[model samples]
Target: MNEESRTNIGTPVPDASNPEEVREQVERTRDELGRTVEALAAKADVKAQAKEKTAAAKEQASEKAALMADQLRAKAEQATQLVKDKTPDPVLEKTAQAAAHVRETATRAGQYAAERAPDPLLENAGKAASFARANRNQLLAGGALLAAFLLVRRGRGRR
Candidate 1:
């Protein structure tokens, strides 16, 4: 046997009389095919890993958005609740009652003054007129003070 034939013992001899060489060729082809399959599997695994990471990131972003929306909704609800709490039916009713009382008192005082000073030229006419003017000023000052007090009270109550 020559050197080439010795070195090519387990490979295909390319001669029809070599059954062992043909079997070795078949085994070598199987090993090469297995290696190719392993390489393809590694590429597939990398692609699958990339897809999983993308899916995870998308899921996390969606969760974060949902959480933010929920927080905003909760804040809005709290603000609405605060507004509702600050506005009361009783306070409005009291303010209206106070205004009505002031109007009724002023009207009654005007009528009393008119009845007491029926004649413009009667005795003590000047004094009565001066008293009426002073009374009106007092009523106006009292009304202004009361209104300011109510406004301050209402503002504080809201806070």
Candidate 2:
């Protein structure tokens, strides 16, 4: 081989006057561009896989949260029903009846004390009855006033 030909052996030598060589070069460039596009497509596929994993994680978290909310709602409903079912209604009624009986007995004792005593003993008894009546009225009025004050304070606090 001649020295110049040997030096140019592997170098691209476009035949500027030949349309076929230009077409061949264009075809080779197109193949290289296709390889670059394929590499970019591979990178895009990896990014899409990451996005899909993130979306799946979000969907799973949302499903778990909804399931937890449903369980909490069911437990709250069960607790409310249990409270309603367990109340002691018969015991409350008996307690009310016993309180009424005690009131009646006290009234009878007061009436008997007024009726059976002598005049001198009756005067002392009358004074005691008057004091008892005044004390009862004061206690009732104080209790009512305290209840009203507490109710008013509670109402204001809620607001």
Candidate 3:
């Protein structure tokens, strides 16, 4: 509301007979039309709008990734703290020693079993293994058939 433009706001249209006034009016109309076109053009800028949407999506993804990373870190820290609290150094050492003992025992038992097998028994086992390998598909199908028959027989027995 400047005093000057305020007066122009209510100014009546000049007579069409005046060439200069008509020209000025047309120029003003052209300026207003250009401004309207510019506004519409800005609104209709699909590439810019798409870029804005993509940036927003990327920002959201980054925020989510950061949040997930923070949660994972917190969970890992909590798990570490819980493990530290529940298992003292002596307990951990004993657990490790127990695991090693079990592993060693299993290895010794396997070795003993292998050593105690008779030559005939080992040879028979090897021949069976070779045969099974050569007829893997047939063996699998036969095993499946046997399993199905057993299941059916058991079901009948139950009734």
Q: In each prediction, how many residue pairs overlap at the backbone (N, C-alpha, C within less than 3 A)?
A: 0, 0, 0
Say which candidate scores most in lDDT. 3
TM-scores for candidates 1 onward, in order: 0.30, 0.31, 0.40
lDDT of 3 by residue, 1-159 (tens): 785676467555667699999889879889988999999998899999899999999999999999999998788666555654655465555555655686699668757867998888778877876896786545443443444456568879999
Compare candidates 2 and 3 on lDDT and give the better one: 3
What would the per-residue lDDT of candidate 1 be over residues 50-150, giving only the tens digit for each residue? Answer: 99899999999999999999998788666555544564556545655786796799778767866776676444655775786767634443444455567
Model 3 lowest lDDT segment of ten: 139-148
Judging by TM-score against the true structure, name the best candidate: 3
Give candidate 1 misplaced runs (Cα > 4 Å): 1-44, 88-159
Sort every candidate by TM-score, greatest first. 3, 2, 1
Clashing pairs in 1: none
lDDT of 2: 0.70
lDDT of 1 at 84: 40
**How does candidate 2 fare on TM-score?**
0.31
